[model samples]
Target chain A: LSINQVNEMEYEDFISTFGNVVEHCSLFAAAIWSQRPFHGVKQLHKTFCDFIDTLPKLGKEGILRSHPDLAGRIAERGLLTTESTKEQLAAELNTLTPEEKANLTRLNEAYKTKFGFPFVICARDNKKAAILSGLEARLENETEKEVIQGVEEVKKIAFYRLLDILQHEEAEKLIGGW
Target chain B: LSINQVNEMEYEDFISTFGNVVEHCSLFAAAIWSQRPFHGVKQLHKTFCDFIDTLPKLGKEGILRSHPDLAGRIAERGLLTTESTKEQLAAELNTLTPEEKANLTRLNEAYKTKFGFPFVICARDNKKAAILSGLEARLENETEKEVIQGVEEVKKIAFYRLLDILQHEEAEKLIGGW
Candidate 1:
């Protein structure tokens, strides 16, 4: 839908479309739905980020903890959220070799043990090798630093999700209707 | 974990464990993390219900909308949240024959068209027949009445989910640490 369409969208429609832009943190979208008539997508993204930025450390960590691990149990069970499954597949996380999967499993656990939250990166923006190395690198950061980094990664994921919606909206416009 | 243990558990652990009790609304759990030291499971349940009760109309609808539809596209894609998947399967929604699926799909769409949010029942507590008839019956209600009923159904879902967690905690306690 266009920005004008979004501005005029009903509350329920606005949420169902963009609520998941911030992963499972639809509360971010719900809280800011009142700030309608967003000039464009960028301001909409900023509203979500600013709401997220206001949360305390524990709240931010909760957001990180909401993310499933890369090649983790949820993926193994084929039950990742639609957004997560797409992002993971985009990173070729599903194509990892047995050894790579095992390594990722190990590092994901270690990262959680170290920071008490799952390691989160924008899987759509990183390949398996980058994801593996990034996990190893992030495992060393302090919890506070990791929370900030993880939240930043969530925002990156959100940005891509928003863009995906925009592209689909454009395609829908061309196709006339669903 | 016991309420005692839960009372002392870290915020991240608390969320990761109980966050999905309200379907995908982890924000409910996150919003109440500070109100720790709940006397027991009932108290915790009340806390959640109270938090939910406080939400305004749109907010309540958002919670209802966050839930995936019964036997809907998300279930067909096998991407329903883990909690929802189990609940739907328990209701035997996954076992519907082609004709049954078609009937349910038609009714579900009719219900959604009549009321903005999907028809939500505590699927774990109701069989497919009940669900189908329930959908047919509820379609005639006013939207405001449906919203209240839907939110009440959500609370029932959350109640069962909490009890499942409590039972698991009991079993875990009996088995000792992993």
Candidate 2:
């Protein structure tokens, strides 16, 4: 839709259109609903991000914890969002060996025990081996460092998600310059 | 931070420690502060994720939108979070040619115009060519399909980020089955 079309959308219409961009977080779309006339996808993304930055700490954490673990039971049961399912499949998380699955479960348990949250990471960016090593190495971090690290990882995930929803072909154009 | 230690932490301490695991969202830790005696990281992660699933749509979106763009202006300016910086670097987004940078800008702008969000993808999972091609190809998707696609990409990123922060060495053990 054009900027004008977006600017003119009703709250429900806008939310319906953009709500799932953030997973289960439609409120983000609603919050930005009033801030229409977005110059383009960048402005819209900025508006959404700005609002997130302004949220209370509690609100922010709530958002962070919303994501399910990679290769977790939720994912196995096919309960994850459609986007999540495909991403995991892309990463071959859906095809872990029995031994690999057991290993992930153990490491995931250990990481959470040390950090008090799931080990958050952008799985698509990593092969299973890298992810395993990462999980092992990060276990040594202090709680403070891990939290900061987790949040940063979450941001990367969100950025990619935003790109997916926006369907920006320019991603290649931006990178290739071909 | 063992379950016992986590149970014993003050609210402020808990949030301070685990708050950033979800980017700027700290409320996740806070909400689950009282749900101590977590069996392990998997349980802790589960608890946090379960709480998130229950959040209003707006809250979820806030979390989703908290991320900065991959190789976007923020990353270019080195303003992205530490975790993000490292992830982008891993994908070699930091080394784009000037022409590539301009192309990214163009693609980003076009994507946002159509979908009202940034173009998100797991940079680490892709080389520049793949990313560019992905951007080009995905532009043809309907908005609804794209939103689902976008969120899946975000999940992949988060999964990798989780691995980065948690640092589980058992990854090798699991892979090696040593």
Candidate 3:
């Protein structure tokens, strides 16, 4: 979304869209969206705790669906920095590997059998190996706790990505001395 | 260090040691250590903003070195849990990597080539690949910046590890709740 569009968003609307980001992968999206208003990367970090404080609690199913599967060509893709549909297609279709394809299949089966939902992980700058590792390790966790932890991890990921996209030079300059 | 040793540290000693951790990493280590004798993790997290407020300037070199390379085996290896060793290690090896057999060769070479000090990272629950990745990444940074960033990274790693060791039950409880 453009800064102009973001500027037009009412506080409530801003909260809603950004909240969806957080609710999806509380750790990843929250980390990215947590830094708003075009500040440089430096001051961008200061806002994280504030964002954390305002975070809404996510439910198990909501958290489960937040992350996409790592199979296909998705693992090689980076975080989505724009609203273009083409970017999404390019990322997903070009990066899948044979191992990731097979692993994702097994993960789908296990996740469906255990929790009736697909496994989720906020996937920005994450490889298929990392995703598979996370998925396998999380399987050992109680469904309830894993859901919560997954949300936290997602938010963290979001907060970081948000900084990369939102922070501007002026913001960085203003906060640089701090 | 044991609770008893930590309990014995004067405020000055505490601050100095904590500052070293902050000097090492500017994120959670600085945030958590900025507040002392926190009643609980909740309090520590709650006052995260206040802690950030107390952060010193992030100089160029210092900021770059904030993240240390994680050592897979060294991270898994345990530290002496008493306060005496904690203080001594804190003073003497302000930035030392955890020992690992596989890393000894490279770690030695890297230290000799880059700086006069051994590589350091906060090695909690990290594996060899993760730590190696950190080392390789930091090696790309300029010497001055790498040291600063490395110290900060080490601080973050240590702070989390310290919290884990100190309030073992509480950390577990918090992890479960998350």
Candidate 4:
């Protein structure tokens, strides 16, 4: 939808449209619902991010942990959200060789054993090899370092997801002033 | 550290050691510090993840947004945290060909334009080709789908990072009961 159209949306309508952008955490949309009539997609995006930034540490970690593991049990049981399924597919994670799957499983277990949560990466932005190597390599970091890294990755994911919601060809043209 | 050592650590020592694991957000360590005398590494990891899960959404997103972009301006300025710098290097994002760099620049801009933040992937988990292709393909996703996908990736990054912190040989043996 056009930025102008978004700006005109009622609060509930706005939430309904943009609330799901950050996974099941519609609270982001709910929190920012009253700040409607965003100047454009940029403002809208900024508002959501800013709101998230303002949350306490515990809340932020919850959102970070809310995501599923890459090709972990959630994916195996076909329990991932639709978007996750597609993103994993794009990375070709669904077609792993047995060795690759075993490796991933090992990495996932190792990663979880250390970090207390599943390993997360934008699978669509990586091939399985990269993901596997990343899993193996990051296993050597300190806990403090890893937690920070995890959150940063989550933000990037959120940012891209927000863009997907806001940017269409026409909206991109308008936002880019094309 | 061994689960036994972790279990014996004073509250201050525990936070001091593990506090920075989640970036500037030390609350994870702080909140869980009192729940000390962890039975083992598995229990320790569980405590941390469980604490994170208990947080409200806003707090969770804050943690998610705390991370720096992979190979974005922060890295260009040489201001990424030590771990991030190493992780990006491991992925070889710092050594892009000029053409590849330009492509990355273009993709980054397009991605940020479409999304509100920089694209995030676990660089250490991907090759340049995978990163580039992942960036290129994800641009076609709808906003909600992308947001979910992005957060999922961030989670993977965090999971690996956590593993890095918790998975020392001793702890692994303890957790694995080997």
Candidate 5:
């Protein structure tokens, strides 16, 4: 929906549409707007920052529940993706030099052991080489910090995607002016 | 590591430790210097943002590769300590009336179908009731736009997390001067 529509939405409707955006992004902060009719995007941005600052304090149970189970084929394959990449990653997985494959396997195991989850990176934008390099480098991070940093990295990639989706000048103006 | 240690490290080392951060959160912009050290927190912050603003435009594939997976369980569960209410979302999810659960389920499916992914909200500091209410509202967003907004929310959350991890300022100087 257009920003104009968003602005004009009934309090309930606007909140609903906006909330879905927040939910899909895993943004708990923006979804919980204490007051409606946000003064403007600047106010909204400030509120957004204040909310994100508190995520690290969540205990282990909270963090675990926050993660989705990577079950079934997805568990084996690592993640779901477009058909092309699925084929590409599969092919690359096959062709890895025995050494490269071993390193990847080692990196993968180290990453999971350190972080308590798969070493997930947004492979969409990266080539196989860059992905491997990133995987190797991140394996060195102490688990606590890596977990925090990895989540943030995921958030950044998600934002770029959001900008792509929203062509609304008003939304841009909201962010730009803010 | 302490902010002091971060400051003491060579430029390349600093980048290595925090490069992923700059890569994902700082807009993919980099400023390479043959022989200049980041002298202080203010200088570092400015350089970081400058580089971020200069990030090369990413292609669709590149953009897609940038985002990490959403914290689904976190969105559905977790305690939003940042909010005054200190809300527990999992409990709220459990308490969802049958109708609410159905709507959420439908919304989740619709959101994923349209966006090619599940709805992601950065629920670091929100109350559970607020999130559920938001999920109910946002499900109505057009598929494309909702995804866009979700990514943006994710970016803002990531930026905040970056600052937390890279504490460039000396606490005494930061607070005392402020």
Candidate 6:
């Protein structure tokens, strides 16, 4: 949908459409709706960033915790949210071998044991190799720094999800006019 | 676990054990871990209450929205988080007739339409009758009043969840000492 279409949406429609733009935290969409008549998707993204930035450390950690582990239990069970599934598939997380999956799992467990939140990366921007290596390397960072990095990744993921909602093609516009 | 046990837990163990105390807003657990070595469950409960109180209106609404509707889709699909499944079953929501379920679905949609969040009640403290009647009456409330009331219910639910954690029987203590 176009930014004009977004700005014109009712609260419920806006939420249902853009809600998962931040994963399960539709509250971001719901909260930001009041700040609406956004200049464009970028303004809306900035608004969400501001809202997220204001959250306390615990709140940010909770947001991080809400995310499914990359190629972990939720993905294995086919229970990922629609957005996560698509992103993970794009990154080819669904195609890892058993040995590769075991390696990622070991690193993921270690990372969570250290930080108390899952390792979150913008999987859309990274293939399975990058994710595995990133998790292994970041496992050694101080929790404070790692938390900041993880949240930063969350923003990148949310940005992609936002683009997914806002992208409109010429053909789509023509179809929409029907 | 005893209050003493809760006080001494490492951060990861603490989050795993107590995170769901606020439904999906585990950040409450994650954040409050810093204020730890709580005097007792009551003190811990008080800490959570204070943390929640500090949230802005939007934050509280986001918290409320994280809850599943009583007798709603998650329940129908048997996908409730373990805590929710127990609470809803306690309220006998699982046994609702199809007509009753339809009635609740209608009221729930209306409630969300009005307030932009779900109708939340502490199901363990209420039967299906109370929930239905409460949702019906609360639907008439102004959005501001209802938000306050809904959050109040969330706190009550959280309190009960806290007790479930702290309540250890004498026999259980015997088993643990083994």
- lDDT for model 1, on a 0 to 1 scale? 0.79
Tens digits of per-residue lDDT for model 3, A1-178? 5455654553324444443343332222223332346333434334543444343332234334434444422334554334212322433524556766677778756864675345655555355566677778877778667656665665555454444355365345443231
lDDT of 4 by residue, A41-120 (tens): 66776787787666555555545555677887778999877667877898899889999999999888788678665577
Identify the leading candidate in terms of lDDT: 6
Tens-digit lDDT track of model 1 for B1-178: 6678788876556877888988778977865766777976677888888887866665676677777878888888898888888899899987899999999999988887777678899897799999989989999999989989998998888877776677565544433221
TM-score of 3: 0.33
Sort by TM-score, best first: 6, 1, 2, 4, 5, 3
**Residue range A1-178, candidate 1, lDDT tens digits:** 6778888875557878887897677766655666777876667778778777866565676678677878888788997889999999999988899999899999988887777678899887799999999989888888778989999998888877776776565544433111
DockQ, model 5, C-alpha based: 0.02
Instruction: Provide DockQ values for all models, in the order shown.
Output: 0.14, 0.09, 0.01, 0.02, 0.02, 0.25
Q: Return whichever of 1 and 2 wins on DockQ.
A: 1
Candidate 1 stretches greater than 4 Å from native: A167-178, B1-17, B20-24, B30-39, B42-178
Task: Give the local distance difference test score of model 3.
Answer: 0.45
Q: What is the TM-score of each candidate against the true structure?
A: 0.60, 0.49, 0.33, 0.48, 0.35, 0.67
Q: How well is each residue in B55-86 modelled by candidate 6, as lDDT tens digits?
A: 77877777777788888777778888999999
Root-mean-square deviation of candidate 3:
21.0
The CAPRI classification for model 5 reads as incorrect
Model 5 regions lying over 4 Å from their true place: A7-30, A35-49, A59-106, A122-125, A168-178, B1-178
Interface RMSD of 4: 10.5
Tens digits of per-residue lDDT, candidate 4, B1-178, equal: 5666777774436655665555444456655765667765556666766765554444444344455656777789998776678778888997889899889889977876675445667676788889999989988887556655665555455455555666477445544231
Which candidate number maximizes TM-score? 6
Candidate 2's docking class is incorrect
